[model samples]
Target: MWDYSEKVKEHFFAPRNAGAVDGANAVGDVGSLSCGDALRLTLKVDPESETILDAGFQTFGCGSAIASSSALTEIIKGMNIDAALQVSNQDIADYLDGLPPEKMHCSVMGREALQAAVANYRGEEWVDDHEEGALICKCFAVDAVMIEETIRANDLSTVEEVTNYTKAGGGCSACHEGIEEILMKVMDERGETFDPTAVAGEIKKPTSGLTNLQRMKRIEELLEEIRPNLQRDHGDVELVEVDGKYIYVKMIGACAGCQMASTTLGGIQQHLAEGLGEFIQVLPAEELARRAAMGA
Candidate 1:
């Protein structure tokens, strides 16, 4: 059994504002029985002031879900609409002293429902595909955009944290690999270390169809993808040679002599390894020059 915090248990056992608000100006509903959680939030606002005069909720899920919804209602009760909108899943968790990581999604549900209600109240229709990209988690109808947004917003670094925030890998776990890929992509976009070792499963071996030239082309393509990022800081990289499984490259401009040069080289190696295979090594020009000077 999970250890429920005292505040969580108190809210779960006796949820405040547990019913619907009469004559609510705005209402938002999200989740489903199939998804294992649902929330309906109704708010009565002082239209002139746009202040949330009262808030109420009806949640259908576990104890955490109920507590989350109840906590959300209490948090937004007297705040202006704009201020209320600023509340996040983390805010809900903090309000309840804290939540178990696995139950974090319950707070997410509360936050989403609140956003929806706010949109509905404002008569704003967001027809845009907020959930663009391929569906990655069929069990919860979650897409790559949802997972990516959750990961970036929460600074989620592990598969478990992603699962806790978005419920992406909480089902049969078939989509865990895809989730991992998205996590890596996000980390790369943020210019962070892309640690393949941190992820579960072995690094995939290069397939037989990849010829030597094709593999080299792939490496160049990946470097080209990273070139713009380096250029932003008055830096660049040039490919010196692709010798067998080794890639010899030289960093240019600011990146060449920076203390982070090795870190940059390591990042390149990790990126290529993620695509090509673990055998691919990226060596900086200085490292090769030192080896040659030593006559090794």
Candidate 2:
């Protein structure tokens, strides 16, 4: 089990504000794409007093995120609009007594939702409509700074490489093509000394360095070609990696999203690996997710 902070647990159990408001003057909805946590905050305002009358929240999230939303509603109720807007992520964290680092973003989300609600009350859009800077990390709403730090810290060999290290485009994958373009530009300017020929070598079979995007494409291609064949047997397969010439595969699909996935990944996986090569390693996707979770 994760070591949740005491405050997180407390809020999870006896959350401060866990209901809907009778009459809300403004409502704000915020969604986190990475964790798929969504929240709606409603505020009832007193026009003459220029203060909040009541606040409530409806949240869909893990324990910490839900707790953060609950706590936020309690803190903001009866506060003036500007006063509520002054509440920060730090204040939320402090009010909760503190949250886990991984859960810290939940506090940020609470603040953003409150601010957005107030922004809505004032009739303003939070996001810049006109183009300013390109999205550098699609998975986490990260901008140029996040990508730049990863590139500089690891001296990234390629964009796909960044994915393995940071899990940037590992989700949804819509940002991969754009990420590729961004990395190339950054690397070119960062004294990589571009040469078309050697650069071409780096472009092909990038998994040698555990680069991210290329390997994802390669594995995705391997899955696309091979999975269809396995589907006939009512099985599943996932191509993971090659260690020294040994190819690895994991089973999923009807197998994983159902009860008999274990039997399929085990018995059927070996059968498929037998035909693939002697060096093939076939395992369950759960096993893979486990190994990944354990940093194996």
Which digits, one per residue and each the tens of the lDDT, describe model 1 over residues 1-296? 86789999999999999989999999998873324788899999898999999999988899999999999999999999999989987789889987775576788788888888889899986232233446687654467887999889976666755764555675667888998898888887888855645653236766525888887798888888778757754589998887666788999987889666765676667666766765678998776778779995
Q: What does each candidate score in C-alpha RMSD? A: 13.1, 16.2
Give the clash count for model 2: 4
- Give the lDDT of residue 5 in candidate 2: 75
The number of clashing residue pairs in each candidate reads: 0, 4
RMSD of 1: 13.1
lDDT of 1 at 268: 68
Instruction: Score residue 21 of candidate 2 by CA lDDT.
Output: 80
